[model samples]
Target: MLNWDDISREYQSEIENFQMLNTPDERNVRAFLQNCALELHERQTAVTRLYFDQEDKLVGFFSLHNDLVKVSPSLILEHRWNLITEGLTHFPAIKLHYLGVDARYRKQGVGKYLMEEVRSIAKEISNYSGCNFITVEALHSSLTFYRDRGFKLKDSTAEFHNMLFSLETLDNPTLEATPLISKQKIQEIRDKVMSVIEQSNLTYAQVAATSGLDEIVIEQMEFGTDVDVETLASVCQSLGIRFL
Candidate 1:
């Protein structure tokens, strides 16, 4: 069992004692949860959600705030701008500021559960506002996790990449359930490749062997890791696929 509460003074001490001992990133997550999360929460600048285990030990937490998503002129030119936006370029969005799980709870689905909670909250936000996207500045190591959940790269800086998930994707009748592939460029490629592989008898290991690429490479590709064009071509060839 678990309990969810917004960050509050009642849990301040518990929040402070929350441990995230693993990587430099984990330490930073803990630092924010202890030092800054409450301040931001009180100011209403962001909402911080805390989750606890059956034993009442802090398990994980995440923060969120309102944001904006800007449609690039290039994208507007690529699509029917008027049909989709009606002269709008900036749309309301929700930004996930931070998501962290205690190192002790790693691999227990804590992260995924918290992410789904965020998604639910974002969807509710969309219902009342013009918000249509959930955005995040994702760490390099977590890119595959976001991508596997239907997020797409929107932009990037030296330190982090900006990724966004369209809420509209959830309402598509053709896709009754959430599929990792959204109607975006990279996701389209992922959908095609994965769909082909799922339909064929060939295993990922065989594809890697036939392509003469490492199995890890195939695994990375399937999980939305960026691979070079030649490497992608090789894998596609082995899978009897040709990108048109």
Candidate 2:
């Protein structure tokens, strides 16, 4: 049986490799990598990370929401499930975020296996949350992937497809998440990153001259301005940190 240890290593490698986020004619892979890494890192700050592996490699991941907002008039913005209500808690929205696969294993059966497991988990949690919907933001390339699995587009902007599925048929979904064991790892990374930003420590400005703005942007991550996910993901790899 492939276990969580194998999955962790494989997943980390893939997130590092996620730096290859584009093709020849597609978007800027380097730029997108940073933003993706940052989003995954921040999302983990308030959400749980699920893990899964194949024989010797970790290939998939999912996030779970542990908090909820009440269901009421103000909370119900049209079909939206607002989780910021003052004091309502009948059913809460369990938002699914940042689903990705290892680049080498993308076309393999691993992604679907992990996804089905997560959906089943959501179903099991339904009794605990009044049957909340399971939702995800799908990349254009992955839209068919979700649709084939019975998910439909809930909403869409020009760039992403927001999709959903009912959690009524959750099976024995074998997955669980634990918090990362090291905040020191984060701090250690912060030091190297700070070095890059401080400039006096960098030997070569070329190496210091990266295409992404991770050093500065990280300082202001909480600001409303949009930071590039692709760029931050690359910075994470360089800084030796795993976004999971």
Candidate 3:
């Protein structure tokens, strides 16, 4: 029941007052808002949402963008790809790029509210666009924060862990249903697509020509903008890859 605000100059003063220090990730959130968030928004690299209290002070915030996840074949169960797309090796997904709650807002359900807001946005996008999973690269110290919200770990190294939440599970029963694509399968397909693109060493100009997308759009996609599913599919097709 908290109000949320899109980042803007009107809220600049309040945003400047936001602070955090628990982890490097937390500190980065503050730095991003103070220095880089507005530029990222203007460049279409990410969208940021901020939550504020009744006093009009910033309480928590998060950022989201498009991303790809590579899943190892060994992680997938049987027949999952068939549900998504036939002969597809990778798929597109939404990324929760950054999430942070001010220390003063922790334990007051602010974090949960921010996550629910993210889910709502993802669900809406899936209804019109094509998003199979909501993915995140969570800091090792914050793994439990995501896990409690139904995110599953796909991979882990020392610094961060790749996690995902299937959009299918978030579907509302009252709404029209869509075919469910398992997270593991989507990850597998993403991995394959990226692998193919890397192996081909396709340049941005070549990809723009092949995909029939504007060079600027293609460049933005490379920089993690949340592009429409159609554009992504076109890019994949041009790359001789299938995406679902």
Candidate 4:
């Protein structure tokens, strides 16, 4: 359940840590983040959040903001039309300020899921008349995901491989997907792992001793914290998977 309210509430811990840096921590920072999340959601300004669901788990978090294009006077004559065509109601680009998934859920597709949500919301906001480019401070790992989804590089930006996906480009605008791994299902995955060990004739003591994974890690994933990629790889490897 990657809903807004749950996302906001989890930021309290993050805000606390941020406030603690070089100063005594207080509740004010958490309050600010909670308030900002609301503002962003309402204005469609950006969705800043600490990704989490119920049962008090930690997921990744991020912030998005608006950055409408600004044209230089010399370039405006030629570039203005180009900008306008791209949805320059103010300017086409919307900035991606911060984005990251929780360490545990780093590879579970939560980041992509969140990006899809952002893309959908941006498209709805665009209304086809204005707004085209989704400007993000694209991290190296994230570039492939965006590119694979049809976002292209805008020439001027470097490590920030600029990309855009036109709403008109999508074949199925009505697409929707439920979470593939729900709490119940993730629990089942783990249980299956345990069951695998059990069926292999390994004693419970041996299985537990070998797993090394703590209860908190398992519970965190089972409760909606996206499992980390490395952990999943290890888990699958242990289970004799060949997902390549």
Model 3 weakest 10-residue run by lDDT: 171-180
- Predict model 4's lDDT versus the native: 0.50
Judging by TM-score against the true structure, name the best candidate: 1
| Candidate with the greatest lDDT versus the true structure | 1
lDDT (10s digit) by residue, model 3, range 1-244 = 7778788888888788887754566676688888888788778899998888887778998999987666544444431322334365466688998888887666467877898899889989888988777899886445655766767778776567788776776643232322355556545655565567668897767776666444555555554543443455566788877676
Estimated TM-score for each candidate: 0.67, 0.47, 0.65, 0.47
Q: Give per-residue lDDT, candidate 1, residue 100.
A: 85
Clashes of 4: 5
lDDT of 2: 0.48
Residue pair clashes in candidate 4: 60-102, 87-130, 87-131, 104-228, 105-226
Instruction: Give the TM-score (vs. native) of candidate 4.
Output: 0.47
Ranked candidates, highest lDDT first: 1, 3, 4, 2
Which model is ahead, 1 or 4, in terms of lDDT? 1
lDDT of 3: 0.70
How many angstroms is residue 127 displaced in model 2 relative to the true structure, after the best TM-score fit? Answer: 2.8
After superposition on all CA atoms, what RMSD does each candidate show versus the true structure? 9.5, 17.0, 16.6, 12.1
Positional deviation of 223 in candidate 2, in angstroms?
41
Residue 187 Cα positional deviation in candidate 3, in Å, after optimal superposition: 40
Clashes of each: 0, 17, 3, 5
